[model samples]
Target: MANLLVTGAAGFIGTNFVRYWLEHYPEDRLVGLDALTYAGCRRNMDALRHYQQFQFIHGDIGHYENICQILREQQIDTLVHFAAESHVDRSIHGPDTFIQTNILGTHSLLKAAKTVWLDEQPGLIHRFHHVSTDEVYGSLGPEDPPFSETTPYAPNSPYSASKAASDHLVRAYHHTYGLSTTVSNCSNNYGPYQFPEKLIPLMLVNILNNKPLPVYGDGLNVRDWLYVEDHVRGIEKILSAGIVGEVYNIGGNNEWKNIDIVHLLCQEMDRAFAERSELAARYPLAPPANGQPSTSLITYVRDRLGHDRRYAINANKMAYWLNFNPDIAFASGLRKTIAWYLDNESWWRELLARAAP
Candidate 1:
C-alpha cells in the first residue's frame, strides 16, 4: 500500500480528490495537510472521519519545517500537491497571499520532498503530482486553438502567475535535482462542495435566493469546464502511470461562454422548481416562456482585472497515454451541481460567512 500525502486536501478540488482516492485506492493510507484558510474548510472532510486509513493535519504548507515533519512522519512516498491560492479575483486584491501560498508553499513542499526522498531513501520510488490550471497559458482568441503542453507560459492574473512560477519550480526540481515530478494543467472545474465564490455555485446560490446574479462584463469570456470528479480521476492517472518530468493537460473539451453558462443554469433551476415541490415553494417562478424569466436576475458587472478572453485545453496526451476521458457533459454536470448546492445550503452558508469581511 502506498503512503500518500495530499496537501490542501480540504479545499475544493482537494476535497474531491481525497474522496476519489479513498474510493479508488482502499488499501492505500492517506494523510491530508491543509491550512484551513478562507477557502479551506474542515466541514468538507467531516464525513471522512470514519475512514481507518486517512488522517488529517491542519497546518500551513508554507512552513518548511512543518512540511518536512509531515513528509517524514507520514513516510510519504507519494504526494499530490493541490494547495494553492487559486481564485483570480482574490489574488488580484491581495497578491501577497498568493505569492506566499502558491509559490512559497509549493517550494516548501518540494524542498521537504527532495530531502526525504532523495537524501533519506535514494532507491525508493516516489512521485510528486502538481495540480495546476490552464490560465497560465493566458488568453485565446476566437480563432486560437486549444492550449497544449507545448504552450508557453503567459499567466494573466496574480493567481495564475504564482501557479506558473510554482510549475516552473516543479519542472526545475525535476530537471536539476532529478525529483520524480509530473504536472497537470487543467481547465475550469465545477462540481459539488465547491465554494459559492466560483461561477456555477455562485450563480446557483444567487438564483435560489432570488438575488441579482452578477455576470462579469458581457459574460462572453469562454472557459473549458471539467467536472471536478473527472479532473480528480485525471490526477489519479498521473499519479498511477504518468511519465516523469512530463506535463499533462486535463480538460473537458466542453467550452462555453460565461453568459451561456449563466443562461443554462437559469434554465436548469427553472426546470428544477417546476419538478420539485419544495423548490417551487422556495423559489416560485414561472418557466422561461414567461417574460419574467429567472434570467432577468442576471446583472452585468465590470469585468475582472486581467480576465482572459478564452481558455481551452488539448488533453490528447492524457487520452493517448493514460486513456483518460472526461465523461460529464456540461448540462448534466451543471444539473448535478445545482442539485448539490440546493440540498446543502448550510455548508455554503458557513463558508460565505467565513469569507465575508
Candidate 2:
C-alpha cells in the first residue's frame, strides 16, 4: 500500500503512468498533482475518475511550500517527478517558463523531498524517480551509437538545457544528500492523449483537416520513437526494481527520420480513412487527392532553432538490468495511435479549440 505521488499527472506521459499504476496496482494509493497548465488537461485523466485508489491535487511543483504540504498530507513514499515545460518549440519561443518550471520547479521539489524524507527514519523504503529526455545529449551523428546512461550531457535547445539542469539537480541531491533517487532519460514518445502541438498528433490532426502538415528542415531530423505505454512500463519497472542513484535510458530501438515517420503516418491515415469511407459515404469529407492520398499534405517548414540532427537511445541497460523491452513496434503503435485519435476526435478537438487564439 505504498503512497505514490506523481507530478505532471495530467500531461501525456504522466497521465498514462497514473492510469497504468492505477490499473496494475489496485491496492496502492496514487496521488496526482498538476497545475492544469495549457498542456496539462484534466480530460486526459477523466477515465480514472471512478478509481478509488487515485486522488488528484491541483498545484505547482515550483511552489516549495505547496509541494511540502502535499508530500506531508499525502504521506508520499515514492515520488515520480514529471512536471516540466517539455515542448522544444514552446521553449524556443519563451525560455523563461522552461527555466522556471524545469529548473526552479525541480529544485523546489527536491528541497521539499529532502526536508521530509531525510529527516525521517534512515531505512525508509522511499524512492524519487525523475523522468527526463535524451535531448539532453544533444544531436548525434548519423553513424554514432545511440545515447546510453553514460553519455555526456550536451543539451542544445532551451528545453533540453532546462531538463539537463533538472537532471543535474537530481544527481546532486543523490550525491550530496544521500537521497534515494533514480532517473530515466527516454527518447521521443508518441501515443494516445498526446497534445496536438507535438509532431505525431499535430501532423495527424492537420492531415485529418486537409491542412498542410508542417515538416521541419526537410524533415531529416531522426529520433528513436517509443510508444507511451512502453515508456510507462519502463518507468514502472525502474521505479520498482531500479537501484537508487542510478540512471536508465528507455527507447523503442525503432529509430526513424522525421520525413519517414510522416510518410508512414500519412499512409496509415489514408488506409484508415479509406476504411472509414467504406463504412460511410461522407467519411473523411475530402477524397484522396488524385492518386496521392493524404501524403500530399506534407509541407516543409523552417527548421527549429538549434534542432538536433538525430537522437537514438541505447536501451541495453534497461533491457538486461531491468528486464524492460517495449512490446509495441513502430508501425503497430502508430496504427493504434492514429485509430485512437480518429476515435477520440472530441477529446483533441476540444483541446485544439482551446488552443486557438
Candidate 3:
C-alpha cells in the first residue's frame, strides 16, 4: 500500500479529497494531519472513523520538527498539501496568519519533504503536489482571456499574495533542489462539507434561516465554479500522471456571475422545498411553509475590499495533457450540492456555532 500524507485534511477541499482517496483507492494508506483550526473540524472526517487504512494527526505544518517527524515515521511517499489560511475576508482583516500559514508553513513543509524524499534514489515515484487557487492571477477585464498556466502572477489580496508566494516556493524547490513537485491552480470550488463562510454555503445557510443573502457589490464577480469532487478527481489524476515541475490548471469551465449562482440556488431551493411539502404526510420534517420562495432574502452588501473583478481558468492543459475533465456540469452539480446542504444542516450548523463571534 502506498503511504500518502494529506495536510489540512479537515478543511473543505482537504476533507473532500481525503474521502475521495479513501473510497476510491482502498489499497492506499492515508495519514491526514490537520490543526483543527476554526475552519477545520474533526467532524468533517467522521465517515472515515471506521476505515483501517486511514489515520488522523492533529498538528500544525508550521512546526518543522513535527512535520519532519510525521513524514519520516509515516514513510510518506506522496505529499498532497492542502493546508492554508484561505478566506479572503479573514485575510483582509488579519494578513499575518495568512503569511504565517500559507507562506512560511509551506516553506517548512517543503524543507521537510526535500530532506526526507531527496535521500532516496535520484528518480522515484515520490511527489509533492501543491493545491492553489486561480486568484493568484489577479483580476481580468471583461474582454480579457481566461487565466492559463503561463499567466503572470498579480495577486491582489493577502490571501492570494500568500498563496502566490507558496507557489513560487514550490517552483523554486523543483528548479533549485530538483525536488519532484507539481502544482495545480484551481478555480472556486463548492460542494458538501464546505465551511459556511464561503459564498455558496453561506448563502445556503442564510436562506435557510431567512437571513439576508448578502451579495457583495452588484454580485457581478465572475468565477469558474468547480464541484469539490471534480476538483479532487482532477488532483488525483495529476498526482498520478502529471510531469514533475509542471503546473496544471483545474477548472469546471462553468463560468457564471455571482448573481446568477445565487438566483439558481433560489430556484433550486424553491423546487426542492415544494417537492418536500408534497411528501409532508410521510416526512414529518417537511412543512407547507418550506415551499415558500426565498429569493427575496438577497441583499446587496458593500463589495469586499480588493475583490477580483473576474476569474476564469483555461483548463485545456489539464484536459489535453492529463485527459482530465470535470464530470459534473454546473446545473447538475448545483442541484446535488443544494440537496446535500439541505440534508446535512447538522454539519454546517455546528461549524456556525463554533465560528469566532
| Candidate 2: regions farther than 4 A off | 120-122, 278-292
Task: Score candidate 1 by TM-score against the native.
Answer: 0.97
> What is the per-residue lDDT of model 3 for residues 146-201, given as tens digits with 9 covering 90 to 100?
99999999999999999999999999999999999999999999998889989898
Per-candidate TM vs. native? 0.97, 0.96, 0.95
User: What TM value does model 2 have?
Assistant: 0.96
The Cα error of candidate 2 at residue 170, in Å, is 0.3
lDDT, candidates in the order shown: 0.90, 0.90, 0.90
Supply the TM-score for candidate 3: 0.95
Residue range with the least summed lDDT across 10 consecutive positions in model 3: 279-288
| Candidate 3 lDDT (Cα, 0 to 1) | 0.90
Kindly list the per-residue Cα lDDT of model 1 for residues 96-155, writing each as its tens digit: 999999999999999988888998889779999999999999999999999999999999
Task: Rank candidates by TM-score, best first.
Answer: 1, 2, 3
Worst 10 residues of 1 by lDDT: 282-291
The backbone clash count of each candidate, in order, is 0, 0, 0
* Tens digit of per-residue lDDT, candidate 2, span 71-167: 8888888999999999999999999999999999999999999988887545677899999999999989999998999999999999999999999
Q: After superposition, how far is residue 196 of candidate 2 from its true place, in Å?
A: 0.6
Q: What is the C-alpha local distance difference test score of candidate 2?
A: 0.90
Q: Given candidate 1, what's the lDDT at residue 260?
A: 95
